[model samples]
Target chain A: MIEFTIWDILRNLLLAARWTVVLSLVSFLGGGIVGALLLFLRIGGNRLSTAFTKYYVEFFQGTPLLMQLFLAFFGLGLFGINVPAWLAAGIALILWTAAFLTEIWRGSVESVVRGQWEASASLGMGYVQQMRYVILPQALTVAIPPTVGFSVQVVKGTALTSIIGFVELSKAGTVVTNATFQPFTVYGLVALIYFALCWPLSKSSQILERKLNVAHRNH
Target chain B: MSLIEITDVRKSFGQTEVLKGIDLDVKPGEVIAVIGKSGSGKSTLLRCINGLETIDGGSISVAGAQLLPDEAHLKALRLKVGMIFQQFNLFPHLTAGGNVILSQTVVKKTPKREAEAMARKMLERVGLAEKFDAYPDELSGGQQQRVAIARALAMQPIALLCDEVTSALDPELVAEVLAVVRELAAEGMTLLMVTHEMKFARDVCSRVVFMHQGRVHEIGRPEEVFARPKTPELRQFLGVQ
Candidate 1:
């Protein structure tokens, strides 16, 4: 067997970590935009569009992420689109993240009191104006903690992209393990890296939730 | 022509009828107080006038334009009629002046400087000139309601609707809100109010409408309505028997 030191494993894993971070950031931002569009469709009171968004969310959320990645990777091939692993992984992650974020944000928007709508409406504000000036501002505050909390899931979700041969941190671990035959050290360090990334996000989300709750209660 | 005309207006929530065959006319510079026990549909009637609730039967016209459920008509009706709620409903994220400035800038498309000037003037009229920078949660309930009144007044509506505007305040704070309404009445702002304060109704209202079981059970001058209630329902609502 070739000599593989701790430094070798660490260096390769760190390089792979960059792709994981990059994938997580891109999907999260893309998901936010798509999720907002889906939200408007669902709440815009158009029957057919609303139904489309409803099933769209259900399809992505109801199925497993691994299945989604597999479908995105190979399913596009069947259509002769022949997308690369990076594009497939990006597309799957964004769609999946958007599905979850839509429900999360819809709950936040609904949590605003009915009186806010009535009050804004009575002021001659149209639906869009009410949302822009009154409703969304209030909903945004309530949305932050849960939105941040969801990012932790998005970060971990980048791991599943490995099966598609994206060669991120988790996939790099498997390749390294095959070479060194030390699953314990290699996989153990992989989990450690993921932990290091997600722990602060989870902590910050909890902190934000508590802080916002206290601020609201103070009012 | 009257500023507002309601004829045989009816509204129902699911199977429960909240308003049944109501008819009333509000003229310019009239301050009409609508009073009754809980569930009498007084608040619902006030809401319907501003197109907040869609009427199941009959018609409501404000400023000679019929109140329709469509966005254009409702928007037009709301432009001519302003409403204040029991909860005040000031945008919590905005300052008092910001609350008053929003609709003027947005709905009326007034220039920003003009909207700010209008906001300042209205806030001062409501005795909240000093509170222009305060957020809803930072103010007392009474102060918030005054800002709501300012917000409505900034629209320059032909009439105002008060849905128990003082109901949410502490007893001490109630006087401040009623004072603003009193000033509005004194200035001849056509007003329709749903209230439980009998004294304020008798003192400040041009007419008192006693609603019972979703109909106007009694309607007349405040003195006539309060002193000589013709219906037993009104009498019992007045706690006279």
Candidate 2:
């Protein structure tokens, strides 16, 4: 029976917070690139491409993220494939982030008026050119608020990684709670760390959304 | 040979035939205005000419390039025929100059500096010299339409198709956009406009074609078409004797 000092618990969770940040960045960036490609395929004219992307999005979005972690961790091991908790969690989070990101981006892109497509075409831009030069730029303005907002979800999502035995903030909380038998104090610290990371992003996203709406309205 | 030609062109989406049988021709530098009621296929006719809307039957040739359903040829044909829309449709992310310069740099492959200079001049010509750095959302409807016109002119297409280019403008703003079209026509830019501005059609267009039910109801010099229309449909459509 060891009594864990608040300072000791805080230090351990602070160290674990680094992994949470790293995982969030890795998952967000990986998901962004893959999501962009998925969005391109979704809009491009191939029926099969669209169908495949649709299923990929729906499969990830429809399931609980915790189950995805379980499947990624245990399901792979059952199939004669061994993956560390870190790798399994990262993969599942990346897939989950990509699904939601693609949908967010697709809605933003589609929100561009049909007339914009016609205008770009009339300027002699092919499909790719139109998207790159005309449509995406406008859509990006509309896309940013939601995208920044979604990053908070990515940060919060890192908590589920601990369920797969990845030693992140939540798991550190569990460890400290077991050793110190102070669930209230340990969990409060964990919640505080999350609030610290998420609150700024949430506020910034709100500010950005307001500014964009004002700019759009003034225009 | 006509600079552009459409013979018995037909188009349909799902079960609705948008362009039943359209025939049109424009000599080099000719300005033809196609005017009709909503759903009268005025815009569809312009889109068909630029290969934006593929015709189900017949043919369209622009600047000697024949338009077909094949995507490759459609892109090629679109290059020779520029268009402007009722909505300015400028890219919201890009500045006014960026919108005009993109086609020049990417499709035309002009050097960056030259493309930028040309874009500036086009914007200036459209009375938006100071607004070149502004985004579409930052400008007024008239300004956006002017940028669109400048964007189209930057390509130097053989013909410019304007589909209700001023229809979305405040009545007061319409003249500013029409003034640019008038200026372009004066500079020998072959133009085809689908507009509801009866006065602009009578004043600026060399020929006025009245479309009814996806077919050309009448085509003649502006004076004849507007003053002494031959068909009852034309007179009724025009609401003039």
- Top of the candidates by lDDT: 1
Which pairs of residues have clashing backbones in candidate 1?
A: none
Q: What tens digits encode model 1's per-residue C-alpha lDDT throughout B61-178?
A: 9988789899999999999999999988888888999999999999999999999999999999988899999878789889999999999999999899999988888999999889
Measured over all alpha carbons after superposition, the RMSD of each candidate to the real structure, in angstroms, is: 1.6, 1.9
CA shift of B170, model 1, Å: 1.0
**Residue B153, model 1, lDDT:** 95
lDDT of each: 0.93, 0.89
Predicted model 1 interface RMSD: 1.7
Show pairs that collide, candidate 2. Answer: none
Local accuracy of candidate 2 as per-residue lDDT tens digits, A101-124: 999999999988898888777777
Please name the candidate that would achieve the greatest TM-score relative to the true structure.
1
